[model samples]
Structures are given as C-alpha cells and as structure tokens.
Target: MARSARPVVHYMATRPDGTVPPTCNHLARYYSGLGETIPTVNLADHIGETVDHPSPGEKWYTDKPFSYFHMYTRPGEILERLEVEERWPVRLWEVEPLGETGNWGNDFAPYWLMSHQIRVVREVEAWRAFGHRGMQVLATLAQLPDLARQWTEEWTADPEGTRRTYTAWEKRVDHTRALTGWAFCRAQYSRREAGLQAANELAGNAAAQAATAAGADPHAVALIQLRARCLVAGQLMFDRIRTGEYEQSIRGLLLGAGLETPAPALA
Candidate 1:
C-alpha cells in the first residue's frame, strides 16, 4: 500500500566562537527521535542562506532552517536505504554522516528563518521532525509578544501611582517572555534526557538487566538517564543561545518593558 512520510527535519548550528544557543542543526537532529537519519551542518560550513537555489546574488546572510523532504514519502526510509546501499555500519552513527548525491547525502535545512531576526511560523511542516517534542510543545512560546502583553497587564495592575515603578507594563511583559523562553528550554532538554537514557540502556543491556533483576535502586537508572540528557540538551540550548535570535527579541521586549532579562544559564 502506501508508505509513511518521514517527518521534515529542523537542524540547529553550533558556532566556532563558542556561545550559548537555543537552536541548532545538532539539536534538531538529536531531538527529532528519528535517529541516524537527519543530517547536521556547522556554522562554518554554511556559506549562507539561499532562497533561489544558487542563492540569488548576494547570498543573504540570513539563516534559514533547512532539511530534505520528498514530495510524499517518509525520510526515514530513504535514510535506511542509504545505510544498506552504502553499507556504512559504524560510521552511520556519527553525528555527521556523509554521502551526498551519489551515495545520498543527508539533507540539511534551517528550523526557522532569520533575516533581521527570528520569524515564527507555526504552520511550518517540520515542527515535529526533531523528535516528537521540543520547545515547540510549550504553549506559551508560540507568541512572545502577546504572551508578554498579557503578563504585564495582570502583574502590575496596581503599582504605585508613579508610572516609573519597576512594575511598568514593559517590565512585566519582558519578564513573561523571558520566563516563557526559559521554560521552553527546560522542557526541550527533558526530551533529550529520555533519549539518552534509552540509548544508554541499549548500550548497556546487561547492566540494565542486572539492575532490573537485582532491584538495586530502580531509580538509579533514572538519574543516569537524566544526567546524560541534560548534558546534551544543555549543549543544544547553548547553541541556540549563540544565535541570539530568540534571546535578542526577549531582551528587546524587556528593554521596552523596563525589565532586565537575565542571561541564559547555558552552563
């Protein structure tokens, strides 16, 4: 009959200078649970974003979310086919698998568009590509501006008669956005924790069974899984932080609201 369509992927980038980021190809690929399918690219390898194939003329410096997609087919199948054809057993597991054109290269794309800043498109197709869950699952992150507005209206409704108080609408609004963004990051990492745990269990099958059979702190495995997830998720968050796209907007909104958005805790 018909085959399932592989979910579109959203990859995040990691920069050489070393900065905290909220999104990146690495994060997108890992987060998308599809595993060993989607590809990733470093910021250095990226020439720039293109809209018209050859990139038009100047090759706008804008960063666009990217990933390969067939008209109507699952991406996972394509990847599986490649793995067998290329016979890339051990190498396939590497974060960056190679095989373009002849061997079938891992397609890469941006998760979001950025010209002067980050653009939010809820309808974008690849939302679920990177794992089944991400910051996108968080409800408030959908619209930072509106969320900020609503938060401000309720937070300081009865501030001192002086309009110069810290409770100004601008401050409240900015605070909400920052808080929302932070919350999103927190949830995004949780998914990684789950993924890492699964991977480790698969790796240490014997340890898992022994632990399971002995009944020696069944909860011990939970912490191990969480630590691994956090480590990887932390890196993903830091990569997005480097982009400064989401963070910049929050800061700008906070500035307008007279609130200070605390720096992202990338560490």
Candidate 2:
C-alpha cells in the first residue's frame, strides 16, 4: 500500500482574540523565504474549500490552515480549552505537516537549530536587545545597597539637608526598581537610621551569597547573574510575543528602563 498524498495546506496560529501574533508573522516571513507566500484567509470565507467551517468555539482556527504551525497565542489557555471543551481529535485528513508545531517561545534554542542562512535574524536581534537592556537594569539594581550606604554616611555628616536629599534619592531608586520588577529591597523604612542599617546588612549578605555561589571573583559572579537575568527576560519577552502582546511587552521594557517608546517604523 502507498501512503496518501499529503495535503498542500498551510496552517498559522492566531491569538485568542483572532489577531495574528508576531510569532506567526515571523514564521510566515520565514516561510516566504521558501518561495511560497501563504496568504491569510478566513475559514468563513474559505468554506467548502477542503474542510468545513470551524465552529464558534473553534475561533482559534480563524485564518488557520491544516499545517503543524497551530496555536500561536495563549497556547496554554487554548490547550486547556481543547482538553476541557472536548475540542481535540481535530480533523487532519487533508492537512500537511510542515515543521515542528505547537507552543513555541519557551526556549530559543530550537529557532537557531535551522540553517543559519534561513534563520530569522530579526528575532535574534530583538532577543539581543532585550537581554542587553535587562543586564543594564540588573547591574544598577545590584549597586543600590552600596549607594544606600554612601547616602547614609552623607546623612550622618549633614543630617538636616542630607535627609531631604537622601529621601529623594531613595524614592528614585524605589521607582526604578518597581518599574523594572526588581523590588526585592524596597524602601519601607520610615526612619533614615533604620533604612541605612537595613540596607547595609542586606548588601553585605547579598555580596557574600553571590561570592559563595560562584566560588570565584565577585565581579565574575556579578556578570554571571546579569547574564542569567538577561536570558530569562529575553525568554519571557519571546513568550509574550507568542501570546500576541508584542507592544505591551516591548513598551513595558522601554518604560522600565527610563527610555522613550519610539514611533513604529514604516512597514
């Protein structure tokens, strides 16, 4: 017996709200490099082409073809709906399997597994930018304790005027940390003396632990921590893009870093 001819269909994933996610767009660009441009189509418009129109509950299938690249936005929620709503066992009789499908963006290693020439360089550049910004924020956070100590010494020398200055400085640090999601050592001390003492202790403890963890130079340990934080932030940004929240993710990062959100470039 011979295998049935694979269907020539192309499937793309969309957000739960029926909007196309950036990941799908990036993947489509990747496919375009292969010489075939897959145009977006509504299942309602393409009724009776090869498959019946998807039901109301299957709104996730809007503009979707019968390929492996399914479920781009909020995949976790969609998969849960599939299991609970009894929407699984979907028809794939005339569908063609092109590439590894399912939830993407948990890890970026798979994206780079393909040939370098055809790899999506834009995604890579985006990831690099995310990671670099994350590192800069983390590096500043790590120095907060030291800055607190310096402020404390200055306060002791000139308690009257330095009190006002120190309070303003603390507020700025708190604001920065809150924006960047790094509010581990928030300024909760009502009195300057108490805040300074707490900050010094916290700083010393953090330095000791970092040194012990790496068992090397403290500078090297700091770099390693910065790199790890950047990688995690990049991974999270990718996941957000997969879920069709590219603007929110990118804009939040820019705002957190005290940067202006640039106008969208002409397409």
Model 2 error, position 259 (Å)? 20
Candidate 1 residue 145 C-alpha distance from true site, Å: 1.8
Runs with alpha carbons beyond 4 Å of true place in candidate 1: 1-124, 135-139, 160-267
Clashes (N, CA, C under 3 Å) per candidate: 35, 1
Per-residue lDDT of 2 in model 2: 100
lDDT of 1 by residue, 192-238 (tens): 32222222233233333433343434343332222222223332233
Q: Give each model a TM-score.
A: 0.20, 0.22
Best by lDDT: 2
Query: Stretches of candidate 2 above 4 Å error?
Result: 1-99, 104-130, 168-267
Clashing pairs in 2: 11-65
